[model samples]
Target: MSDAIEWVAVDWGTSNLRAWGMSVAGAPISSATSDKGMGKLERGQYPQALQDVVRELGVEDGRHLDVLVCGMAGARQGWIEAPYLEAPTDLRGLAQSSVRPDVPGSTLSVSILPGVCQKRGGENVMRGEETQLLGLASTQQGYEGLVCMPGTHSKWAYLRDTHIGQFSTAMTGEVFEVLRTHSVLRHSLTGENDGAARDAGFGTGASDGLARPQDLLGQLFRVRAASLLSGRDSSWCAGYLSGLLIGTEVAAHLDDIGEAAVPLIGSTSLCALYATVLSMAGKDGRPVDATSVAIAGLSAARQQLA
Candidate 1:
């Protein structure tokens, strides 16, 4: 890679695409993102979609552009299909399995990292978040512990050294969305809130409802029934739903976690909710800023290029 050439780091997911243009030192000089995620793009638009960013950034031809990408862009529906590296693979192993985009007539050098997958009891897969996990692990010393990345589908990963040891995924966020919008409990929610009411609701409800995992589904419906029968407040239903899902997630995984306190990585709201849920389960979780981790991960990958 030339010192003057730009290197691009991409984090593409099902619903969003983010790219960064950086110097060889990995300092991001510019960045761009779009709603044109893998889920929304047609098969043939991948090159042009990428080119749109290149063009916007004025990346010139004859200048080698090294690209490292993660996320759903490695999925079957993404720009190119990157195979899954099973657990215990580190950055070097992942880098070895990288897939390049087939942009015909273009001379750009690109490598997409393979998503991590494993089959302990059943098949579990992660695309983009694993890189962020690696990024978090890369910068920290003796980073052996669990990393919980909360999102539309929350993932809990076991990391030892620089490799991913084992992991599991819970559809907590998707379930929450389904319950809030489609289930009978929808009527009781006063819509989403970003304030103390929401926090109080989640904190209280998660503490109470998460304590009884066997009765979760039953108690979930009670949120609706209680509002009608006992005059429970509707405004707290959002928090209640958040609590139920997070509580179930905590219950399902707490036994496997052992004594290590997992660090929660993602948006602040998500981290807050997960931390609150973990607290309810008698565990503590600390939040790691995901954006910083993303940048750091990209930088780490760039170091390999040197």
Candidate 2:
């Protein structure tokens, strides 16, 4: 492999497809994205959408487009299904298991990284974020630690010796979305943007009524009643709702894992909110950018191809 090959790395998810051209040293040269994420594209159009992106960038020669992909693109419904590596898999093992894209008649050489899964008893499975977690472990020091990645479904990963130990996922964000947008709670929640109200709301919800995990459903409904019975501002309910879900997730996982300063890999705002909630629960938290980690990870993986 050449030391200075130009390549593209893709982080294609449910809602967005992002591509970056980087030097062999892993520095990004140019980037482009499209709304052609997996959720919106038809099965047959996947190749064309990818082709369009490459063509727009004038990367027709396969030699110039050494594409590495991660995220939902590795799912069963994606361009090609990359099988999940079991718990305790390292970057070397992950790289060996990557699935190459079969874009017929196209010159672009592509490899989609498989998602990692770890079983923690029962039928629970953790995917997608595990790869990001491994990517984090690959670059950052202190690989043996717990990592909390917040998203539609938040993931808590345990890493040891550069391999995944066990992890769990919580449907916190999805439940929050459903309650706020579809349930009776929507009636109490105003779309108003008030920082003071949000802070107070989050603080109140974060402290009260998170002791019992099973009570989350009931507590969510109370947000509606609290607004109506006490003339609670609806706008504040959004923050309350956020706090409730986060609180439940934290409560469920924190004690079992013991308190260690977990590195959070996600957006800045999300990490900040999570940090705030963790602080409320008396756990130390640090936030790291998953985007930068994604780029770094792809670069690390690309080194294998080189």
Candidate 3:
């Protein structure tokens, strides 16, 4: 298996690390994952954490493999900070700007891909999501449009002919989790969202958010109020909060999105939810596989090594 493996592709995010052993043809033959993500590892511990996962991918001892990594592992507090490539940057040549970290005594030759940043219009930066954009560009030649990568920090980027023009981030997911777990609204949400009642609640919240995004702060408390006054269940509250937050995010970028079909990237469930919200706004939301694009982006980087 090691002999067949040409190189490795890694997406090391804040909470998780995923690695895939690739063949010469750019196909992933074996894969592994670890909880020792950038958030959990100290600077000095990154090498060993990576090495352990690589071993699980069946890389033989003493064998040299080139590992191309993307994501938070290149963060300043991560394994080694890969400087941000400012916006209006071409996603194709991310490998040319990649940094080769010096890991002494390790047989693996690792390169960390730099992330994209926008200084204009209130500074913003992204780590692992850039590679996914690159993958999208690689697969869709000369693509140009709006893309929404939903997660803890949702990113909305405008790709103009494979070059990232500008991007924005929203802490929708993180804020939702915090509000659901820590705020007074926690009493109303049970983390249950799998029924027609939940869907109806989501649609209602999305409609309100889309119509009056500016009133979000004031509308948030309505979840608890609805629960207390109308006897709404936890599922409804959970779905409503999710819908409201995502709707607000979509509303903020409505101008950027226009009437074009937006590509929704991220986990399947999350993408589906975003699609629902976009549908509510009378727009099309096309779901794209986040993992496939990440691998394609990594493969595009590995080719640069050759």
**Top-lDDT structure, candidate number:** 3
Clashing pairs in 1: 71-128
Report the C-alpha displacement of residue 65, candidate 1, in angstroms: 0.9
Measured against the true structure, the TM-scores of the candidates, in listed sequence, are 0.91, 0.91, 0.97
Q: Encode model 1's per-residue lDDT on 1-306: one tens digit a residue.
A: 224436888888888788878775667777788777899998788777777766555576556677788888889878789999887678547677788878786667778888988877568999877788778877775778788999888898888767887788888889888887888788887554556666666766677666787777677886787678866566666776787778878887788665667788999988987887787677888899987778777677667656
Rank by lDDT, highest first: 3, 1, 2
Error of 2 at 63 (Å): 5.2
Best by TM-score: 3
> Candidate 3, 33: how far from true, in Å?
0.4
Better of 2 and 3 by TM-score: 3
Clashes of 1: 1
lDDT comparing candidate 1 with the true structure: 0.77
How high is the lDDT of residue 81 in model 2? Answer: 88
Task: Give the per-residue lDDT digits (tens) of candidate 2, residues 1-306.
Answer: 232437777888888788777775678766778899988877778888877765555454555466788888888877788888877667546666889877887767788888877554544454456557656866775656778898788988777746777677888889888877888888888667888888778877766535655688678776888787887786678878888788788877667455667788888888888888788777888898887778877777666656
Better of 1 and 3 by TM-score: 3
Candidate 3 C-alpha error for residue 193, in Å: 5.6
